[model samples]
Target: MTGTATLCTVTAPLTLFAAELGMDEGRIGLLSGIMPFFQALGILSLPVVLRFGSRSVATTALTMRYVFLGLFLIVPFFAARPDAVFGVLMAAMLGFAVCRSLAEAAISPWSQEFMPRSVRGRITGRMALAYVPVALGVSWAIQAWLDGRTGLDRFVPVFAVGIVIGIAGALMLLGLRGGRAADSNAPRRRSLTEPLRDRNFVIYLFASALQSIVFVSISLFLILFFRDRLGMSSGALVLLVALIPVGAAAGNVTAGWFVDRYGTRAIRTALQAGQIGLLLALPLLEPDVPAAGALVPLAFFLFGFLFQAGIAVGTVYMLNVIPPASKEEYTALHYSMDGLAGGLATFAAGFLLAWIGAGEVSVLGVDLGKYEVLFLVAAGLTVISALAYSRLHEEGALSVRDFVGHFTTGNPMKALWGINRYASRTSEDRRRDLAFQFGGVGSLLAKEELIAALRDPSFDVRHEAIRALGHISAHPAVLNALETVLEYDGLVELRYAALGSLGRLKATSCAPRIAQFMEDPNPLLRARAARSLGEIGDLSSLPRIRTMLHDDPDLDCRLAATSALGKLKDRASMPGLVDLYLEQASDRTNRVAEPRSKVVLLAITKIFRCEEEFSHQWRREEVQSGLAMPQILLQLAGRVRTGAPGASAKLRELTSDYNAEDTAATLAALAELLPALHQSRHRDSDLAVDVLNEVRTAAEPHPALLVAMAAILNRIFAA
Candidate 1:
């Protein structure tokens, strides 16, 4: 019952909200029709909500829906001034659309979280049935109430009723529940940046967003075709509009059931083909033929039904591809892409409608509406989307042996042959199970698999091999295999992974060769090379590394330098590290008003702490007098002040052996450094006191050192 009310509130206003605003029936049709454009924008935020947990986000979205719907109702009260009221109403509509989009985003994942996979489709389909009846009822009620009345007065009551219904719907949804818990024995939090690197997920999102644009175009404009082009009366138009929900409901149920029985690929392909057929025939139907008008409702129902089913299947498809831990980020990336595409599509549809004139055009012996061209174009997009969808192989469907041979050897043709041969003989699920077995067979076999994968023709197989190599890091042969591809692979991602693998292997022999890649034209390649260099920690390459710090265009490279320098722990690089820190501090001060720049400053501070620790280690080493220990200690003291949490413990440990005589001489010379190191910024005060106590103990052994230690300690304690 709750789900039914929610669907009613969601789809009903979309049916006639534009009409209430006094838009030319055609423009109103397009206006109300394209609300999904703005709705897509809200959808992009889904990942964020999902990451935080759906329950909280859903409640928040529902509350916002109430606010927006209330504002929508109030717009009619101020309708004496049409333009202002319409503008306000449109704003309200946008707000409501965003809330509903949020609701859709949350519900899909929430449904997945709670429902069993086998029954998920059926349950979602059943829930969707609520929308059909609500849409029909709302359309009938609005058309009936407006039959004899004219002007804004009669419409005000309709909007008022909508507002009340919206509120009730929101309240009901707020009481519904299910969400992922933060403490569920899930894997450790993934790096927030990782999911963006997923190629399949990225492609899937692009296809999904494109699909949303197609649906939005059809939904927003279909009603106008019935009323204006078909010349359907208000009552007939209401019935026609109502059929969309019926069709959508049926599609949802059937698609869900089919998906449970047949899998995503089959359902998606069938529905997309069905949609193409419906779209192609839509333009041929004539308004004068009463039967032709009836076909419009059938067409609407088919498009609506199939579109929803495709979306449901696609959602399942996405969940299957992405790791469960990364679902939120994947969802976010998906919705963000959807929002962007939907917005662009809506804007494009407006221009298209105006350009093509939305009426009949004679082309290649066939009469078609400009709207039909839009549908044809949409059909073309569906084809493209389906093609992209076909590329997603089920997880673990390829053996490690097959993956490696195809990807590493750069022969994808052979890989595709193998996959097709395998597919012909085995079920996809069984093939996937075999693939997992291959993954578990240890690194040597995995290495062999990767080598074989390199010879395969499919990019998907090749890419999968690269990922598996990262996991099966026990093989030194894997490094050589990756390096072989690095010089020849067409994909930059493959090249980057190869470089990263070399670093992961700690292959010092590859250091010089890897350093050469730092000069690559691609910034990402250069950054990868720099990071790999840090991992190898070969000081012989420090000169080249230093050159990159200054010459590389990427900040990631510079950050990698700090990391590399920390690994090398070479005292000679201390000056360079200090200069980098000072440069960052200066940049921060110059851009003090920018929060993002301040974050850069924070990153720089972290690097400086690394430098400080390196210097501390150097001070503990036995070095000749020529090396200026006083100057080094003075610089090191300055670091302990602004360094991160554990600096005090480190400072005390390193300074414990300081000579009382050297301390006395340094205290006077390093008086300025003393107060900075002892500043309250060091959270571990006991460590600070210990440093002072060591200085006091040193004072007992040498009187002059005692004076110097006292002077230094006094300055530090006072500060």
Candidate 2:
């Protein structure tokens, strides 16, 4: 971790120094290929690694790495010999790369064999946390020290710092305690070629190898692109280079948890597919474009960030796939393939760039250089790789579409974040918060957590978990648990929560059981049950709910029943509803209109299919008029049904005269229906026979009332 503070990569000051010599893109590619190619060659150390403990072999090789780096640092002093500079520098780098390769070959197997699997991931994370800030700080400091200065003198200080820190890190490797040399005679030992025979592992290796070319070369090539193609200053490029590690740290932090939550293959597929789009966009970001300066660095940042995440998930997947007995062989084989793939392609890309030197290709009239063409090719290859990643088997992993859907669906990540938060937080408020988060997701991923939470000691947590279960759809466990709570749970609140969740889940199978609760002593339980029955959409519960609406003394019971009847859209309930509305409308003792009256009006509108027509919210002037209007309309329909005198003609006139599409129309129709019912030629006929008998007096604001009053006044004077 400390050694990474030196910031020695194939890309940065190394590329900058390589370009300072007269080497073209070809030699730079060759130089970039050196470390990975030697790392690939390090698999030859398997015999040596097996002969000694993993830590011992890795430590010895890493110590030699620093010695080579220290020798490389002295090359700047011999800069006076211009003819020998390239050979001497190459020789020094060759030695350093070989030693580094041997260390690389030993480290993974050592960690796998000796370190606890639980702590390996944590240690990797802690190392990154320690390394990133130092790497960023050191990079900026070096950029400042360089200050656009060129030549061999710059190489000495950078290499010296790396050697010092790297040597310390190497020596620190000695502190790690346990790993035994492999026993050739042991019965449990598996063949080294066992991983090769794994079809899924081979497919994974193929995909990884295909990706490695672009993966390893992208940083190095971008540095050259910025330097030669865009004319960026050497010092400024240092900061640009540092953005890679910075972006990687951010990405790794996010993926570290996500891989565990969601699993690996789906994430890998999503990331690789996303990277394809990024690569395709890169060719369009030419120097002349308005955002190219910013976009280019952004490309580098994402390149590092996304690949770091891929590595994280990929490592987890590999660990899962590898057999317990052959961890060393599996790891070494994987590293060898990765290094070889990266080495060969990077080495080839240099020559390919050299072949296309200072040349341009016109595609759709857009002038693209070798870098653009290479990125296009990389994008094409990435498509194949992403598809390959999709085919890799991961048990219990969601399909790519479903995994991606979590981000777009109702705050699932927040829910996931809460699920992780639950174990650490024991307070009732926090536990309840966890339940709230799980409820919003509406996914079965939270089912086990939410259901287990149902039995939590904290009543708040249990009650909230009951509510959260309503949000997750189609789980037998959730539905069954809720039913048990509703039927048998002692607490009324939990039972109430269960009923609401059943409604949200549309658990129609529970409708009959829920209907039984409508007759319960608790008004709260009765109200919740009625609503759930309505949402479950079982027509059998309609009669019971209508009876509740007609007879229940509880305000909440009536509200829920009326709402249920509305949802059922039952025309049969209209007569009783009109009776209720007329009683409430004419009751002048109550200053404020009752809420049940408004809800009844809404329910009636829904049944009549005129809900959209008279949908404005009720106010002081609107309530009585609104309630009376529907009452009159329902009564007229009832009369027309029974063939009362002039009833059919009156109803036809009312419908034709006022469309019932506006408040004024309803007011006008109510006025006419009042007279037709009140002053029929055959006054002996029963106009109110089919409905409630309490509607003899016409509703107010009638011009006919003035005439009737005048007639009565004349009669009074004559008497």
- Give each model's whole-structure lDDT: 0.59, 0.69
In model 1, state the lDDT of residue 138.
69
Each candidate structure's TM-score, on Cα atoms with residue i matched to residue i, is 0.50, 0.75
* lDDT comparing candidate 1 with the true structure: 0.59
Which regions of candidate 2 fall more than 4 Å away from where they truly are? Answer: 2-6, 9-11, 39-51, 77-94, 109-126, 148-150, 183-185, 285-297, 362-367, 410-427, 430-456, 468-488, 505-530, 538-565, 570-605, 610-719
For residues 1-719, write the lDDT of model 2, one tens digit per residue: 44462485334777777677666788778777877777675567777777786788888888776677566566566666644666666776688778777787778777665645444444444555555787678778778877756666876677677777777778888888765677767754435578888999998888887777778777568787777767888878887777777767666665655565566788777778767887777766656989777886787778767776676667767776777677777877877888888888888888888988899877789887899878887887778877888899877666787666665646666666676778685788888887887887776667668888888898899888998888877556678998888765469988898899999889988888888898899999999889888778879998888889889998678778877776777777867776765666556777543544666666665654445433432331254433333334444445544334454455455545443235333344333344344444442223222221333243632222121221221122222
Best by TM-score: 2
- Model 2 clashing residue pairs (backbone): none
lDDT of 2 at 548: 91
